[model samples]
Target: MGAGGDAEEGVELEAVREDEPMTDLDMSRACVESCVRFREGTLKSSHVFASVSCPILHKLEEALFCFTANTTEDASILSSKNATPVVLPFLVRFVDFDNKVFLEFHQIMTDRKFRTGKQLCTEGKLEEGLKLMKEAVDINPTKAEFRGHRAYWLQENGQFDEAKKEALTVLIKLNPSYLMAYQVYYNSCLLTGDVRGMQDAILRMKSCPGRVTKSRCKIEENEQILMILKEFCVRLTDLEKTKNFYEILKICKEALKIAPYSNEILVKKGIALFGLKRFAESVEAFKEIPSYSTSFRLLDIMSKAEYLSLKFPPAMEYNRQAIDLLNEAAPERKNLIKFRESMAAISEEIKEVLIAMQNKDWKSMQERAANTKNLINSGSYKNERLKLQMMNFEAGAFVQQKKLDEAFVLVNEVLSAWDTNYEALSILVDINITVGKYHDALTDLERLKGMKKGVDDQMVDRRILEAKTKQQEMKHATEPPTRFLNLYTMLKLPVGATDSEIRSQYRNLSRTYHPDKTRHLSEAEQNDANNRLLKIQTAYGILSDPGRRNNYDKGLAALESRNKTDSKNGLVIRLEENRKKYPKVFGLASSSEEGIPSGSSATPTTAPSPESTVTSKKRVQQEDGVISPDKVKRFKAN
Candidate 1:
């Protein structure tokens, strides 16, 4: 041996001599030192030494063996223990070893589970996929990615509520700025029709407090949100065709959550609410549109809603604003001008009706009510609430004039068509009281009180007391009249009849009641024939227009729901009464199979307004600051 070999041998002999005297504790400590050096790459596995066997030393040896052999599973298990007892001081010296091992194992298991879950979901095994996804999340609770996967699958499984809850967990607990979680939540809310939840999700995405951390591409994030809103806008147009005003409003609310100032969504929302007869809410939706908007459609719709809501000043202001925005050559300009004229006429007639009622002039009240009806029936005006008001006023006039039969007929028809019309119900109660039918009066009064809960309590109570007192003197009780004279009934068509069926039936009825056909009858009969023709024309006007027909259908549904005991028997009775009263006019003998009245030609026409009488489409452009025809055309083309 060389001198170097001899020197190494002498050192090993001395180390063995030193190791021989080491205690079990000392051996454990020495083993831990060896393990640390091995982990730090400062010592080779072959050179590592242990002098004696001990529990702690054994653990350290096992851990080092697994680490060297690349058996991460066993190493991870060994690390998850009290290092000072299990692996002596090895893990304590490498303080991050246990954590690092745990993290690696967690990542491996979570990835395996997540990938398996995704595959399962893609294979349509939702329940199994969901389980695996949940397990993945459990294995790595701090990672938002696992939770987001679980949430999306849950939504696909139709577990919307659970999906949203899981998504919230990611957004709130794991990752406050997680974008995927927000998208999952939004989709869940949308499918479930949770409007407020969808809105919240949209708002959160748009204004995420930690968006910088959540997304790398801000433009992509914004495009995603805008895409959602665009989808809602497209849905609104389809919903309009269905006349599902409620659904349209919900979609608008959701879209507005992402873009609160979207003019298109707001206008659609306003129109939907207006169609629903929610005039106040419609006005509120319209008001959200920026006042600087020059949209003619927006202003026109807002004006109509405001007018029906009885906000006359604002209604007129909106109309004038819309007019100022239009040119004389615009087709809508003519319609708008006619609309403004009709509004003015209706307003004047309403005031006159009120004044007549105040003055106890039944004739004047009836005439003004008739004028309002004529204006509404003219097709240029379209105020739903105003039409109801005029009907109530007309009935009130008949009641005050002591024409009880006429009053009864009108009130019954109105109530049957609009059972929740408090004004018509009140008029019916008045008629009952005027005829000394206290029982009927009491019944109507109680119904009114219930419907008007928390309103005019004192007035309702006084009326109830009077009705009860008068009941003691009543010896007879007759069924308060109920009649169903809906638009369908007026045209003598089935409830589910098609538009063509409606037109054909309308033509048939018009021909039967046309003055030219009924001219051979007596003068009284001819007058009755004219009245029937007018009613048929009004019915056609309502049923022909899709929007008006939808509103009427909705009203009919509400009426049926409110008056659950409504009977077709009442309609049969009313029809019989009509035949008895106007035998020569309504009887079979009066029916004529003569020519059909020209549908459009027979349509009632009002005298041309001063604005419409202008033969020249050209007007002074400077007046009202009206844009020129050419400019208006160009602006509209955009």
Candidate 2:
């Protein structure tokens, strides 16, 4: 007979034998057919499936075969009575002609068991879940879905290697396109530091051509992609924390390819680049983020990159924006305070540099620049722009000190690295002008003008004019006469003055032009006096010692002959002019009929006669008691 005639005959026989209870075999067969009919939507409005109030049916109706069947107690009873084996044949008979039905049955059973295991896991019964999941996998050894669940439980319980093996079995041996299996495999690779394996799994899942026909599996494909990207982001964060910037950047790029518009991933990529000292690239990465995204972290990183790149104005603007966004963002963000403090410190450093530049404090500027460079080198600061600014500042200081070669080297280094650096270019132009390299200065100024977006073009134009004027004036002039002053001219003395004479003049001039003596004068007058006092001290120091004086006389003679200039004539003119300008300082009288002192015939200065010196000594002895050696000896003997 056909299967339909056999079913009808069986039903008729059951009705005829109503007085006798149905055998376990009969009940199992009936229950299996009922489940199949119900799944097919042909059977309806029946509470009892096989002469028993089955809770599994109720659970299936409520959870739609997605959750665990809360019938473990009944299942245990059935298993203990050896009823599963009797039921197994009926299950096979109902699904024998339809592989779809068999697949659905296995899927439902696997999902139920996996849900039960997950519940146990949530209830602090991890070991119980592990054992139950293992049993589920053993029952359906060929089902990739069940093995994927088992792999997850294994990973949760710290059996990473075993989890990886199980996941690989599911993906490679059973179902190559299983999305859940790929997730498990990816996570296992991540935890074990197998980055290559993780990457391979990501590529495999991405390239999956939808082998699994289930709608749920198709939905899981997108979900698995998201999960993998999130996992990579987490790993990137961990790597960044350990300062593994290169690895972080690599992972960030990999994740970016999956979700190109993901703001979180882009932010992380920019941060990694910033950590790697790739400031320009880092800024470009951050710029990929959409304008509407309210991410303080993104703004902060962009500001830092700009600052390091030496774009101070923009860096400050970005910093303000970041701070404002942080205030408007979630108040519970843990890094808010720390980020603010860091920004504040950077702002302070920039302010100090700006102030020094404005005041033209070359020495202070140089010192601060050194300190900023140290901070950058030590990784305390990550602003490349700040480092460039510091280099420019030091070069400016060198220019002020007339260290042209050193200044040129540093300025060129900055310009080569960042051609658009306005400050560095400006300083380079100034150095060129100072060294009479007018053509070079004009070239730099032209470059600067071309790149001057927000800067004062008028100021640059004026500088250009000044450079042209100086260049023209140089053609007519005799190479700009160098002002070389000898020690005698500096101290207002003749070149051949003796040591005692130089010392006497130095004492008088120092007291007269001292800063303390000029305190009552105007600020300009006081500054002039201070400068003069410094020059006088330097000249006196050079001409005070006999050895130094001898060397100075020789150098002075050589310099005078080289230039064909008589500085002694200039010294005499300065002495006469000073005698009129400050009469009390240079009004010492001279005797013309007296002879010059011994050992100073080169100076040609006349003094009072020898009788005048004896009379002055006798007067000093009468005023202050003078004791002879004979008188002292007689008194001691007494």
Candidate 3:
């Protein structure tokens, strides 16, 4: 049977949930954790999620209803209704988003809140846990954890197709280093009675070759990885064999010590940690993931960890980050951990500080260099681009704070990269134009045209026109042009312009400036048209013929290069070198191969096969360290 047909037999888009009561924490923390795994680039977690399409779609229908119900809130930021724990459940649902939301949603996501939200998912409320995970993913679609959980929940609920797709998307985002995603994906298929997916996963895992790590294996470490692999192999060797959670834990501990950050090893770590009783450590270990972060696993493990220790620092840290991240989350998408832990962190005074900090408006530029330096120094972001944007923000803040010199310094720093940024160029351009520096403005406009993409073309044109008008006003007006001027003007063909585009440009120019049509032209108008007509004629004459244009361009380039070289005052010295490359042609053969002298060998040997001919010929031609074909023949002849 075909793959799709076989998969059809395995399951349709059925909404099935395990009858056993899922952990209450499942919705909050687990869902968010899965999204992280998704963002971190796990595919299996996404694949397993495909199994819950019906439930996921149903949840989306509800989120849509929630979105439409709120009248005053921005469509960009949806708020949640607090009837049931919709945040966890809704977030865990499968949603379609392109793979490019990585940096765009940074302002909306918090790593801490995501962790706590996932803890709630693990508390046996599998349905609710999944929803929150799904929401976290919705807010920060770039996160791997959220997507992974969505996949896990879907697969558990029998939506394998959706789970598999989610897995693939995560893999694409994260690349193929994510073995955990594949593992979960295999489990999703295997759990749903489709053994083929598991087998396929195994095949893919093998064909890709010795784990993505550099093969710098100390024999002991290699043996340890092998041992761990063998232990995990038992899970598949006999699907019916009951696995001891402690034994699995022991195996992961040894493997982790050897390759602490290996994705495959980490995946093995997660599987083993799942069954261990020290659920908090296990959660931390899982959270310290290298690949395939399942939001479901994060939540399931997180809830268990919270139960293990409600006031743990890791859990608290999780809440804090989640709060910051959820700003961009959909309404009703709050994490329980974030909500409660954040309440604990906020005293009335701290809340006041947050409120006070929001009020800032500045018109004057910064004046202090120290203010600029201090502002830049305070930023802790590792990403270079983000650091730059934050610098801009700091500069703006300093300006509002009445630090003029600081603002200028900061703005100057920006100008270092974007010297002619309109925001910055306005400073110089306005000053130059006000002082009647028409040449400066024209020079600036000329340079601006050569800039990379995203330049404001219209703004450039306006500046150019102003510069030209100033130039005209400064110079005396020329008399009218003669009627004898050619219709074609000076032609400069664009780079890579096809023959068709060139022809079209030429035709358009030809029709516009024909002199007979300008019988009613004023003196200035006639002069302007006549000049344009001359340029058109020049352009057409130079570009219309292919050979002429090519030769002209080539010659011009050569002349320009020669002028540059001459200006540099460079020196050249010639050296005589033997031309050994033409051995026979130059009448210079090696001493050993000058002629056959006193032959030694007469027996002939069979010729080598074509593949070895080069090697055989070289072997026969050696005289001492050098190759001498004639010497070799005489030696063999004797």
Best by TM-score: 1
Better of 1 and 2 by lDDT: 1
User: Which candidate model has the greater TM-score, 2 or 3?
Assistant: 2
* Model 1 / residue 135 / CA error / Å: 59
Taking all chains together, each candidate's TM-score versus the true structure is 0.41, 0.30, 0.23
Ranking by TM-score: 1, 2, 3
Clashing residue pairs in all predictions, respectively, total 0, 5, 131
Which pairs of residues clash in candidate 1, taking residues 3 or more apart in a chain or in different chains? none
Local distance difference test, each candidate:
0.64, 0.60, 0.44
Cα displacement (Å) at residue 139, model 3 = 37
Q: Candidate 3, 290: how far from true, in Å?
A: 14
As for model 2, its CA RMSD to the true structure in angstroms is: 28.3
lDDT of 3: 0.44
Across 1-638, the per-residue lDDT of candidate 3 in tens digits comes to: 32233234432223336785444343333333444445456633324223322333233334434433433433234435422353423332322322232222222233323554567656766666666666667666776666776677666655667788777666568545455566556555444333345555555555543465112213344333444545554653342244444445565566455434444445445555434334445566766653323343344345434423322344444444444444455452354443443323322222232223344323221222233234334422111222233344445555446443444454445444334343333333443344344555465555556453454678778988987886564432222224433222344455456667778887777777777867688878978888887787676676668997787667656755664555332111000011122122112212221131101011122323433422232222110211123322432332
**Mind giving the per-residue lDDT tens digits that candidate 2 earns over 1-638?**
33343355554324327787666555655665666565556865232253433334322322322112323234334344434455543333332234444345545555566667778977879898877677667756887767887788787776777888998898778987777777777776655445566667666776666755233333455456657866886797788677676777889788866755556677777877766556778888888776523666677677666655545455666766766665446552335444445545555564565567668887777777777666665543444445666687778787777665566667666655555566667776776565454655676677667564445688889999998887666443323236776678788888777778888999999999977788899999998998899999988887787798788688777866755443334433443453354332112223221111111111212233434423332111110011123322332342
126: Cα error in model 2, Å:
36
